[model samples]
Target: MTATAKPLPAGWTIRLHRVHNLTVLTLHDEHGTDREIGFCPLTPDGPQDLTVSALDTIAHPRLREAAQNVVTSFYDRTAAARHHRDAFDRAVPDCRVLLGHLRARLPGCRADLGTDPNELTVTLTLTATTRAAGPLHALLARWPGHTGHGGSLADGIDQDLDSSGALTAALRQDRATEFLIWYRGQC
Candidate 1:
């Protein structure tokens, strides 16, 4: 895949650039543009190609975490990515359990999980705006399953969780006020 940019929290942007044999990672914002955050030399078949960590490069803890997620998306060779993909494969069944739980407790709530064809993005759509946020927070908090974190969503999904335990990044798409499953666990 070619170089791409993904939206970050607070109107920031993370850009991944693949130039020749090196992967250039940068963070962009209105105040500062294209600040180098991380870089990895491309080695298609080598063991160290995607295993490099940016902890030493990035000083800020929060920004480092965000940058790591973006950097990890550029590679699927890591064990974490493998674990994420495995869990993603079982999203349907896991979501079904969540759906059942939601409906059982909230009888009139309208909720469903929709997975994109590429399996990179899954939408947890709560159609009832009046009662969506509150119940969702409770349900998700009590959900008896593993939760994916950091770059587990992979690809381009945002990791920003709102006060209601919903992903605010999901609001960028569809324009509907819906909560998204920010961290999904294989149950």
Candidate 2:
């Protein structure tokens, strides 16, 4: 167990330790689940030797954003340009607008942004009961990743419920998903 914590995002803490000459960045959630984001080889220059890809693997969306600022600070001209371009290329255009519209369309529901553990992609998730499914399904019909090869919503959507008893229907793309609506039964 670690003694103290660092100034990270709310409810999250970061710890760094040396392992065989490498620095491993670990994150602890509110529940104290320790997740090893990734590790980088130590050098005389310290974290400046870290690459964009290596730093990008830091989990937790807020923590990732914080790490990106520090990681990109040491990048060279070419690396910095590539990092900027890749970031722009990975973003979903007008994402806030879409989320706002989603919230408006499904009143009383909640909408949130989700990122994969690897920080490679982003998703917009709408959490609602089956009562909102009809509207959500209609919206999904027009969006990409809505239908699988068979042209059925079920095909595209993950059929199984997650541990939280919610199923997600995602419109996946290269860097972002158009939408990832989570359906849960009413309480």
Candidate 3:
């Protein structure tokens, strides 16, 4: 039987492209190939930023450590992609666990979970608004998870917990805010 092309998943798009002499799967966009969500080769120039972004949202230190363990373990694109996919799978359950924990710990917050192509990465977004000081501080402190040192929410608007936590002005009056956490690895 001839193998047919698999269709894109709901809410995801995939395209094939050649970059730096390597065949890469450009996921989630059909256009100019900027903002890639996944890659094959794991090259120094191949979407490492997005990969790191995905890893940073992992709440479990062990899962993060496991990803670190495999960073140098693969020699080729296929192997590395597999490794990455594995890590992403490991992190998915943990992400769900973390979401449950977050939902339990913080009232009035909403959570969403999603994945990139080949299931090599996951993104979790938690949104909440500040009606009082207590919930606001709680949201800010829970942010960035374990690996969110450089990542920020809403274009760095939430970088400073102290300043951003305070809903003092008209813009802040909206109170609704979102924190996007990404976890990347092989599926």
Candidate 4:
């Protein structure tokens, strides 16, 4: 009688290979499953060729619209500009708290902040170009209106210095929700 060899155990493996600026990825699963993914640094196209497309596709118009609505609602619910501005002065630390909340809840979005007693600004940008905008958009759509005017959606993306003359003490607030929505829609 002849004896046969035993097969390998169940597991997963990833292999990478490159050729002429192109990268090839191979994944093998212990259950005898295998798949390949590929990427190229160069393309045959026009001026847009300089841009790199996301490997994954995303479809989340509803989520994006929800985020926009949230921003607008936050602005409308707040009182006069001066009152909102004062609230911003009182919520500089709260802005940081909100940022942490966003990062934890929205895996693909990131927030950059600058604030002083007089101004506060937070810019949330998309970090994952390939994933669906749902999670990030949902997070932003729920941003609490109490974050203050400095933390409001109307703020722009500019760093401000505080009253102490130290860049650290500047109270400047700017929100970049539109920027995030624009990025989410980019192909």
Best by TM-score: 2
- Per-residue lDDT of model 4, residues 64-171, tens digit only: 232233323333433344465564546443445555655566565445533332232332333422242555444434544214476644333333233442221111
| lDDT by candidate, in order shown | 0.43, 0.46, 0.39, 0.36
User: Please, what are the lDDT tens digits per residue for candidate 1 over residues 1-187?
Assistant: 1234333435555554456665555755546565335664652332222222333344434434546655455343234445544564454335555556656666545665454434334444553333555654455445332133651432333434455544322312221112224323312
Off by over 4 Å in 1: 1-87, 116-120, 131-133, 138-187
Q: Kindly report which residue pairs in candidate 2 clash with one another.
A: none
Ranking 1 against 3 by lDDT, winner: 1
Task: Candidate 2: list runs displaced more than 4 Å.
Answer: 1-91, 152-167, 171-187
Which window of ten consecutive residues has the lowest lDDT sum in model 1?
171-180
Which is better, 1 or 2, measured by lDDT? 2
Q: Of the candidates shown, which would achieve the greatest lDDT relative to the real structure?
A: 2
- Displacement of the residue 6 alpha carbon in candidate 1, Å: 31
Task: Name the lDDT of candidate 3.
Answer: 0.39
Residue-by-residue lDDT tens digits, candidate 3, 4-49: 2123333433343446644343444234433333334433333322
**lDDT score at residue 10, model 2, on the 0-100 scale:** 49
Error of 4 at 16 (Å): 55
**lDDT score, residue 168, model 1?**
28
Q: Write the per-residue lDDT of candidate 2 for residues 9-111, one digit (tens) a residue.
A: 3465445554555655555555667633545454122332322234335444443444443323223333544554455345545556656776777664456
